[model samples]
Target: MSHALGIAWDMWSVGKVAAVLLVTFILSQLLLSWLHAVRAKRIDRKVAQLCEQSPKHECQSNPPESLPVTLITGFLGSGKTCLVNRILAGDHGQRILVIENELGAISIDHELIDEQAQKNAPSGVIVLKNGCMCCTGESPGSELERVLDKLLDFSQGDSASLVFDRIVIETTGMADPSPIIQVLLRSEMNGARFRLDGVVTVVDAKNLMRHISPQGPAGFLRHRPEAEKQIAMADLLLINKVDLVDSAAMVALTCALGQLNAAAKQLRASHAAVPWKYVFEPELDAVGLAQRRQAALSSDGAAHGPRVSCVTLTAADDVPLDALQAWLQRLVQERHEDLYRIKGSLAIAGEARKFVVHGIHADIQGTLGGEWGGEPRSSVLVLIGHKLPAERLEKEFARLSGSGRSND
Candidate 1:
């Protein structure tokens, strides 16, 4: 009877211990769940606060170590290739990688890159002749991004020490740089690995007046819209073939360019002869850009003229991706001819990364940009088109993102 009693006590003790362990585990799991909820709330609050902040607010500065890139864009017959040759033949000591983006079967520029630049890029120049860098390919991201992905993989390159310190991209004559800039800005891979230093647009001075407007007797032909777009987006404008144009024509062309983009500094030269300093110049800091914007506001000339206009739309909340896509598609389809380009960093519901979107006329495409990281998770979009309904677009985007205000 005594042995039986001892066994009963032992069993009771074991039951008590088991109960304690179960209760501890349950409590721990509950604590973890609570902590996660709290963390999520904190992140949401941060996003809300940042959304209310200024657009010029700098979230995080680019680290000093990432390779810097200079993008060259221009209309056909502009000395863009000449400028690339100058860069390739430059005496700059840094190792460089040149990306020649063309739509043709053969890349003449790739062959035109002299042996000196090849010495800088021991792996040789990369040619992405499939299509324009901004246009959508079979993949979600731009073809340029795909090329960037491979080059940025430092471990997979030929040698650690021979890694390129700088990159120069020579885009096709008809290229629009806005989408390319959007890609660079949105890609976290680029964010971590490369810095898009700035865009330098080379203009054809000899053909400027002829392309700016219809000069023929009938006046049926329209102006070269791409020329103005290219000029407007540039941080620096290099007017090439200046020797071919008279002083009065040069002055007129310069004035037109300034009116299109009051922000960019202009230089005149023959054969794309620009200094190495301007070729690889960094973009203006936030303060400088703000000042430039102010200057543009105070200018006397009509900005962008009547042929083309650019509008910005911004909002604070996230929306369903499919609904947003459907709405945008219908809008783009209806206004395909009028809308030249559409690009945005969008906030999608339940998504961890920002949805970066690019549209050329009717062809709208999007892909996962990157995690929010340290930046504010607000939606900002740029629409470049002919006579855009800015106020209407602002209101629509505002309503879509649950914001009462519009940045337009």
Candidate 2:
């Protein structure tokens, strides 16, 4: 009888231990749940406070009348997209949106822009993908108006009560930005809530001359006049790819650029990467328009005009980087006056990737851009200058290919 009583006592002890453990677990869970609720509440309160603190009619207010717009413009492959990516990646704390114009049918810039936007969370970005925003036509303009309408709706609607703080429009490489500006500056749209911030132009130091010319034997003389127009209209000019130009050429280029647009502020950059502070912190004023107008009026009497030209050559296959470099060096030495810029994508053998090559006068800059996903492509070299000899340029490139030291 005593042994039976001991067993009963043991069972009772086990039951008590199990009950305590269960109670502890339940209490811990309840505590965790309460903590989570508190944290969520705090987050909500913080977001609300931020919303309240943000300037009304700037980002959060409905029916905003004066929204800032930044227009980014550049030539093809000039790294405008890169700068835009950097700006969007920054911590502006305000809601932002982007409008991009793709050069080709592929819309590569759109993908890059979206990728950057996704990386910079919390800010909203929208892409208008029909065609170049600067194109003149019913379809393009209508599309732009529709996009603006949508943005307006967002600003007014409850869903977009926290609307974007800034809007950025990236024009196609070949687009003329004047029309786009006109649309935004329309007096009729004064109530549309969009304001013009400024036009930022990205200039490819290596290809600046080429972009301006694109037609001579060396590919720099063609369409030379239009290139000047682009520079003349810029509010802010970013001279990118500066690393590709030597001191002498860089100085000359800077001098030429200054002559081209004396009123616009010029900034130097490598890989088209610019500081966000300089780009976003500027207080765009009405004086810019006045300055531009004055510059235009005085341009007819200006003596110094753009002297560079451009030439383009397409290669059937990848050429060795070393060979191309040597050729470029020789060209710059022999034809520096006629050779302003050279830029293109090259396919190098055994590298399994594409290499980007850019040159300013005698200076050459190159880097590997990862493996090539598309089909085998030829090299496109755009040479910019005056009086470039097309035959000589071709012969030099061909000779470089023969040396078999092409890969670098």
Candidate 3:
């Protein structure tokens, strides 16, 4: 009877040990899961805070009554997007808003923030697309008036008050920015709601010569002369792509650019990157609208000279990727003399994606943007330059489409 009791006791002990082990395993899993949840929440909060403090967010607040508008301009393939991104990553004590004109329908800048979110960045990003404001017949003055009206409506809304410290307008790569500037200087909407801050023009160090010389691919928009006009109008000139060019070349380019526009401040940077503090400096002097009016009155060359010719080519069908690349390479190499800026969207055969291409002279860059959302549309290529023979350019494209290989 005693031996039987001992065996029963031993069995009971074994059962208790197994139960304890099972409970411990479950508790460990629960603890680990809780830790992960806490970490994720912490990260999300951080990103949200960063987003709120970004320059894009700060623009929502009204700028100084005297100076309120900022124009960010850059040539094709210059690091304008990079600079914008860097500015958005910092905290600049005010609400900011960005109006961007991307090369494609979809803004790649929005995608950058989305990508950061996936990697656990702590910020909320939003993209607003209403088509290129420049292309739209919407008068710049009217647009500003409409935007201010909307903002006021939002500010008075019950949900929450809306405010902005500054506003930034980023023009498209091919857009001539003179009209937009004119709107700011001459628009009746000019008042306490908005002020014209300054114009920042981004230049590519490697492509500056190509942009200015009639021999390069961009030589076609009459680009050399047009680019000079842009340089002349800028308040701050950013010389980007410094890494691709040597120091001597960069210095020479800087001096040349300075000579073109002595009134503007020139800054050299690689990737068009700069400190956020430099861009959103709070130092703004008050200037009345009447002063702006006087300046406009005094300026004689504010209007764009004559309408330049633009040649546009639409693809018959989706072209093969290799074929298109080869064709473009050859065209850029051979006809660099007549190309000002090549801007367009392309559909590559056999690929389930759309490609966006931008070129200045011989320098060309492309990427598979988003997937094909709608039916294949004809590719639109606009070549802007002086004395561009539409027939010859079209003929060359036709020959390339027929030939399997490019002249490369």
Candidate 4:
């Protein structure tokens, strides 16, 4: 009887220990759950506060005192560089920072333009070494984010601590302007500092018709031609070299452009000669920047058809905190044929440095970037490809960034 009593006591002790362990585990899980909830709320509060402080009183709009950025894009030999130089040479009296992206193996536009300016150029001009800023990174540290970081540093280092009054970006002839525009519009850091003033497209009047129609004698029908896309996105269309085309041809071309983009202001000029003020301060739609952001996010590249589309994803927290690498690897392996270009920045978890991600076709990269200064660690990702699974990709990014659905 005594032996049976001892065994019962031993069983009771074991049950007591098991109960203690189970209670501890439950309590620990609850604690973790509470912490994650708190962190999420904090992030939401920060975003809300920022929105409240914004001049547009919306989370997605630019600050009232943000710098203005002018984007110049066009076809090859369409006088994009020439237009940029003209703006630089003009007596705008505002300090300007120019970002130049080249397409060839060697960059010569910056030097050529500087030489042509003959001391009338802007305060500083930075030439990007990548072949094309729209889609040039094989790893992280996207060309766009790197350029923005540099701009921030430069603006801070200036003696007056005064950022340039104006910033101009000249894209290569063969680039898609949509990604560049998205970067300026969606990037939290960029929107806080620089507002998109206008998009000026320099059209080679001689070749404009040839590009607009694939059946023209030149027959330039690529899968995704940049010329038509450039025209489609232009706020101001400069039909350059009008002398090459007769008045009747000019009228016809203008009509054709109107059909493609009725909203854009069409102008004719010889040698890209247009008043700088027109390019810099065109009458933009009166909607606040937040409304503009909504329009941009909803309608970006919508008319490009199903064969090619651009998917942009945004996140409020840092990525790679979870399985970012595994997810990206799966993306590249599964979608190499459809993936064309990828670029953006990430706010790393528990780190001061920002992570930049870039991919061109199958080549993908992610690299550490500079620290975020007084700005929330919001992340942005832009993808240009054919038939992308945007929903799945967005979900994965949201999971990585710790935002439940989407950032913005």
Candidate 4 lDDT, 1-408, residue by residue in tens: 999999999999999999999999999999999987875565444333333333453555433677788888898899988876666555666666666665332234553343433343224433222211111112123345434444444444332243357777777788877655655544343335556677888899998665556454445454336776777667788889999988777666765655444435667889888877778876533122123234444442313334445555776656664477787888889996676556556677777977766555566667677778776667766665667777887787777767734312
Model 4 RMSD, rounded to 1 decimal: 20.3
- Measured with C-alpha atoms, the lDDT of residue 4 in candidate 3 is 100
The candidate that achieves the highest lDDT relative to the unseen native structure: 1
Q: Compared with the true structure, what per-residue lDDT tens digits does model 1 show for residues 188-257?
A: 3333455467789898988865666546675436567778778756778898999998777766777666
By the lDDT metric, which is better: model 1 or model 3?
1
Q: Candidate 3 — what's its lDDT?
A: 0.53
Worst 10 residues of 3 by lDDT: 130-139
Candidate with best TM-score = 1
Q: lDDT of all predictions, in order shown?
A: 0.62, 0.56, 0.53, 0.61
Worst window of 10 by summed lDDT in candidate 1: 130-139
Better-scoring candidate (TM-score), 1 or 2: 1
TM-score of each: 0.51, 0.45, 0.42, 0.47
Cα error, residue 222 of model 4, in Å, equals: 5.3
Model 1 clashing residue pairs (backbone): none
lDDT of 3 by residue, 1-408 (tens): 999999999999999999999999999999999987875565444333322332332454653344266777767676666766555443555455555555232234453343432343112224223111111112233333333322333233221232446666666555566545544443233333454567788898888766665354655665446566566556677888788988666656765554344334567788767765555542211121112223333433222222233444555466777867897888777776555445556666767776766554565666666676675444555554445566777766555445321110
Candidate 3: list runs displaced more than 4 Å.
1-67, 103-161, 187-190, 216-224, 281-408
How does residue 230 of candidate 3 score in lDDT?
62
Candidate 1 positional error at 140, Å: 14
Clash pairs, candidate 4, are 139-365, 140-365, 140-366, 140-367, 141-356, 318-347
